[model samples]
Target: MPENILVIGGGPAGLHAANELAELGVSVSLVERDAFIGGNPKKFKYKFLFPDLQPAENVIGELIKKAESNKNIRIYYSSEVTDFKENGKKFDVTIKSPKGTETKTFNSVIVATGFEHFDPATDSKYSYQLFDDVIDIKDLEKMMGEGNFNRPSNGKPPRNVAIILCVGSRDRHVGNQYCSRVCCTVSVKQAIELKEHFPEMEVYIFYMDIRTYGFYEDLYWKAMEEHDVQIVKGRVAEITSGPDNTVICKGEDTLLRGPFEIPFDMVVLASGMEGGPQSPEMSKKLGIELDEHGFLKPANITLSPFKSNKDGIFLAGACTGPKAIVDAIVEGGAAAMNAYIYAKKNAQ
Candidate 1:
């Protein structure tokens, strides 16, 4: 019998893992909670990826195509793992889909369930959803994907825009003390896009600290030096209604040590990432550990991030923590190799 491996996600990591395992001659079962397979990037309709700013379709679309064409792979759309149990070296898994629930035993399992975008409304300060012009990063991505650059409140171009960083992450008051790593780079990327789209529109990024890290700094530098995007050293504390259907960003300018309230045509909040409810659900079903930050804990974060604490189960992508798309893809391939080795050795 062939080594049957179960990959619980259809996102970048899971898709890449399934494709690799299929090429390795393993029977791959991919399960996704949503009807489609591309995960958040697909769900949010991301136009371009960060760092190099390549088209999202070029990366996510290729991964989906590769997995769908592979004969060794089977996909379960709009489905989830309802039950998981250990049966000696192999495991028995029950999948629930629209068609019906089916039980299958697999030699190894890989969990790549991704993260959720942090909702700015939960904080009550950013006034997300309360104002038509105030939106988050994901919302802007979707709008940009559809080639709609007009303000949500009115069908007119924004004169000046304020992009607020650190909406939900890195705030102890909001209960998440960790920084969502990609938000900084993503904000910078979107700022560049806005400048390119509307050169005359003033774009200001209100940030406590600009963290573009490593090679991503190139994009940040280009946003300012090349595009004339302004950087404000401050964090917006309150968002209130402004005159002429605009929104006011009220906060202290840390650099100048003075409080200022500025009105803008639109406000874009740089919301962070969260583990979502799936982390605890997967932990309970798979009997793995959850980290302090509410992500899936690996057997060894530094040595074997792809390996779970359980012998026959593995982990990949943002399920482990907040990660960039490229990092998630690499983790998916790594997890696939580890899972294949375990399945080959312990195959029944």
Candidate 2:
């Protein structure tokens, strides 16, 4: 009999895992909470991550096509795993969908729920909800996708835009100490996109340190030399709205050791990434362990990138930790291999 496997969360991680296992002749079922298969990557219009500025829709569309064409793969959208129980050598899983709740048996499972943006409402200085013009990087991406770049208060293009990096990350006060690896790149990407759209607009990024390691470092240099984006080495202290629908950004210049305020037509908080909202519930259901930072703890970092504490469970992508798209895909494939080996061993 073909080994039965369940891959949860239908993002790049889940999808890639399922595809890889299915290629090895394993019966794989992928469940996603959203109506669509692609996760956050589907939410963007275009991803400008250096070398190539490709449309996210196209990338996800291709992945979805490949998954659909695979014979050993089964996909369920608008479905969520509600319960998980170990019975003998198999896992009895319960999933809730629009139709109803259903139970299935699987030899192994892979959790790839991905991550969510950190909420900025905790910081009163950022004024996330109070100021209509103040928005997070994800929100700004959505707005740009909808062709709504102008401020809500006035239907005019922003003359000056400010991006504050590390809003909810690497800050002990807010309880999130781990550095979200992608914020710096995402900020630079958005800044370049903004410049491409509005050549005359002034774009400034306030950051403590620019982390563009590996090939991404070249992109940072491009943004600085070619795009001419203003990089400020400081942490933003507060953002105040002015009468003219402008925003006042106050932060101390670490290099100059002085305080300064720059009035901008719009302000964007480059929020950090965290585990999904349903992560806690899912972790509890599966009896999987989470680290102090709330991300899934892999069984062993050196030997296994996807194996979890549970015998038949695995993890991949942002659920394990922050990773780039290519890294997520690689981890997803590794998770699938782990699940395949478990299923084969149990079948024997």
Candidate 3:
């Protein structure tokens, strides 16, 4: 019999890992909580990705296509690992799907459960959901995906828009101190897209620090230089109703050492990512370690981020921590290689 492997989550990392493992002559069982694959990128209906501004469909669609076509892979849609038990060097797993419950044994397991977008509505400061015009990055992304870019309140084109970065990140009050790696770049990308769509409209980015690290800085520069997107260096303390059916951003200009209240037709909160409920659920079910920041803790952060605490189990993608899509795909390949080596070596 062939070496069988179980892959949880049908997101980018899981899809990539399952495909790679299947190609390596391994019989892989992929379980996704969603009825369909593609993860949050699909659920949110992302239009374009940052850095290069490429169509999200180009990447996510391809991964889904590959995984669906692979002969060595069996995908259990809308399913979950209800029970997991270590069987010596191998394991016995029970999968519960819409159809029914089934149990299987596997040589190794790869967990690629992805992260969730922070809900800006929980913060209260951003006034998300309270004001129809006050939305988050994911909300804007969904709008763009549907080819509808207008103020949610009145269904009209916004005259001026404010894109606030680090909405749910790097804030002690929110209990999320770590920086979400892609929010800055993603905000910049959205700013550029807004400018391209409506050249007459004004775009302003309010951020404590524009952290477009590495090559992603180019998009930031482009948003400023090419598109003339104004950036204000201060965090908005509160968002409240303003005159003329607009929202007021009340905060201090740290650069000039003064307070100001600016009104905008629309406000887009660049909310960060979180480990979500799945992190703790997976930790309890799989008996893995969850870090202080709510993500799954790897065996070694530096030496091996893909390896989990338990033997024959691996971690990959945003489930471990906040990361870009490119990084998740790379980690998927790495985890697939490690899992294959272990499964082959310990074959029954």
Off by over 4 Å in 1: none
Misplaced by over 4 Å in model 2 are 44-51
* 161-195 per-residue lDDT for model 1 (tens digits): 99999889999878888988889899989999998
Q: Could you give candidate 2's per-residue lDDT for residues 1-348 as a string of tens digits?
A: 899999998777888888888888889888898888877877554353343666665666777777889999988889988888998778999988888888999999999989888889986779998887788888878777676777765868899899999989999888889899888887888888888888888889999988877888777787888889999999999888665678899989999999998888888899988885667766798998888888888888778868888899999888987777767878899889888888888875
lDDT (CA) per prediction:
0.94, 0.84, 0.94
Better of 1 and 2 by TM-score: 1
Candidate 3 structure quality by residue, lDDT tens digits, 59-105: 99999999999999999999999999999999999999999999998
Give model 2's TM-score versus the native structure.
0.95
lDDT of 3: 0.94
Q: How well does model 1 score by local distance difference test?
A: 0.94
**Candidate 3 error regions (>4 Å):** none
Model 3 TM: 0.99
